[model samples]
Target: MKFALVDDIKTEAVKGAKGICPSCGSEMIARCGNFKINHWAHKGRRKCDPWWENETIWHRSWKNNYPIEWQEISLLDEKTGEKHIADIQANDGLVIEFQHSYINPEERFSREKFYKKMVWVVDGTRLKKDYPRFMKGKSDFITTNKPGIFKVDFPDECFPYAWLESSVPVVFDFGKLFESISGISNPMYCLFPKHENYYALIAEINRKTFIKTTLNGEWLSRTEEFLKQSKKTKLNRTFIQPIENTIRRKPSKYVLERGKWKKRRRF
Candidate 1:
């Protein structure tokens, strides 16, 4: 949604600029409103892509972090002949989607399948109750052997359940606007889904760093660095350690109630 084709070249939205949609080749007009961020819209107010969502400041902020070439890339599936524009398709085929709105589980699964290697950057502060629910769910978190990596025993009760069973990794932006922070130091939490539990990897570097590492296949090395750094204060029982110790000693259990998990009462 950020870029349209002007004079057969990808162009950013500017006031009074007329262009064409790169995806559907439809006529587009630049919308530079006082209240909303400037963007391109189909001339007839029609949607070319059914999967497209209304762009927000949150989405634009994330897209601006990457290079212009990498933003709004059109990907085609040779096998299925399906085409879609990725929010960001890194140099190494890693698709990063910045999601601010709610989506059903089916669509989430379909997107994950289409993009074999991808990561989701969700806006966790979208709803008023999101942060409070996540805070409550944190009580059931357990740290993993990998520093900054934690396991949530019951993920269904968490804030973003749409991606709970996502095959790819997911990073949550707790509405911590990344305006002033450098790309490499943007703090985020990565979630990796397993059979019944979800592993949460705390961001050591900024969002940019994580993306670079993942693109270069250096994520394992990054995890190692965090593990070694975590040991220096192992004795002091810092933030990650205590949870790791607690889970190591006695893992908590939950019961399914009305499609959600309820922490079992301990005697």
Candidate 2:
């Protein structure tokens, strides 16, 4: 499977995950949705930590929970003939970078012009926050009155993206790490894939490992099998109405290989 390491995971991905800087131990961290993975940005004192700007809430958490060796990398900014430090680097060909700086013309075009197996976490602050700098027409989860409301304004040109509840952009390989949701440890994973401004109903799995089989449409029958082995199901849910609606709209598109509980609808 192809994996892309991002400097930040989408805020939506962290909606219930947790909120704290991975490095300097700060609470003023924010996450936005990027192509498929989420992007994180730090907003606080600049001098307290050197790695704060490069680390997001999830990144910090990942480091604490699982300390993996990362290498320092340098990449040339094509727009400006200068070199910048890559956010996080793996021994393999994985390079993670986060762009929290205010987006200027050069910065915007700089990302577009660069060609590497890189992940970009764009800002959706206008959609997620109440700052004076927020852009018009951006969605905000805080302002929206609806429950289970997560919105992120994504640029159409971006690839493999998901809109998080914080109205932050999250981009990733939709087919790869998405399965990770089903394996979450404590917090139940509830995923709602919102595309084209359409949202599916809430659906969840107790743990991340379950996502792989569930994604294959085995939730109903496999629910029992998963329950017997699940460590945390007290509050676990992930849903996508479009997929269900798709199957309902066209039953021929899906093949039910499990059992006769086909007519049972939980939502």
Candidate 3:
């Protein structure tokens, strides 16, 4: 983990430093090496939390974008007595989990359920095939009426299958900020939770804008409002589809006017 409890305060790992794990209150010893980023380790390499994973340079770099106080937050479920350390919990109770390694579908779903109001910032550069597949699928991205928002037929073709069924927003970071690809600016793509007509919704969000809105707590509210409105729109479409289909297949061009059926013949 990035931060541990030292002197009753959250502190980063330093060489030969001893601290306490913020979540479990276990003894933590700092190990600073050239190979790995400086981090606190439990005795005998045992982990207090089962869900804890090794941090990567990409993960640490993303964490640095947010404030130190917001990083490595420990959350507990009072009813179930479940406790886990979140990567970042914003001021407005939004959890941001920066994932750089591969995770199975079950664990991913579990994390989403635990962090109800959360977003996943996945590192897309981890796997070579992932970026290529996404680029290939980008050709099929249908433009929506809304700016920067797109409609995708099969999101599984573009993103990892594990994330296609996520319950919250999943933001895929293809490259670091200022990293250009094919001479074009690389922006993070966010996949929304809901899908309509098997068409997934993805938004091309600027990295800086994502960070800014997320920091100021606008991202959560905006996402909630969008999902709410999307649900209404989808219901309206579903309700109107049958009527439109029936009218198209009616075969007879007749209209009820003045209590009598008026017929018109096709030419």
Best model per TM-score: 3
Query: Estimated TM-score per prediction?
Result: 0.76, 0.29, 0.83
Model 3 ranges off by over 4 Å: 176-185, 234-267
Model 3, span 20-108: residue lDDT tens: 99888889899899999988888677787777889989889889999999998899999999998899999999999998888897898
TM-score, candidate number 3: 0.83
> In lDDT terms, how accurate is model 2?
0.32
Candidate closer to the true structure by lDDT (higher is better), 1 or 3 = 3
Per lDDT, the best of the predicted structures is: 3
Between candidates 1 and 2, which one is better according to lDDT? 1
Predictions in order: lDDT = 0.69, 0.32, 0.79
For model 1, how does the per-residue alpha-carbon lDDT over 59-127 read when each residue is reduced to its tens digit? Answer: 998788778888888888998989988998877677888889998988988998998777788887898
Ranking by TM-score: 3, 1, 2
Off by over 4 Å in 1: 177-186, 196-205, 214-267
| Tens digits of lDDT, candidate 2, 29-123 | 33444633353334555333332244444444333321244422445556775554445444433344444434444443354345244334333
Q: What CA RMSD would you report for each candidate?
A: 6.6, 17.6, 11.7
State the TM-score for model 2.
0.29
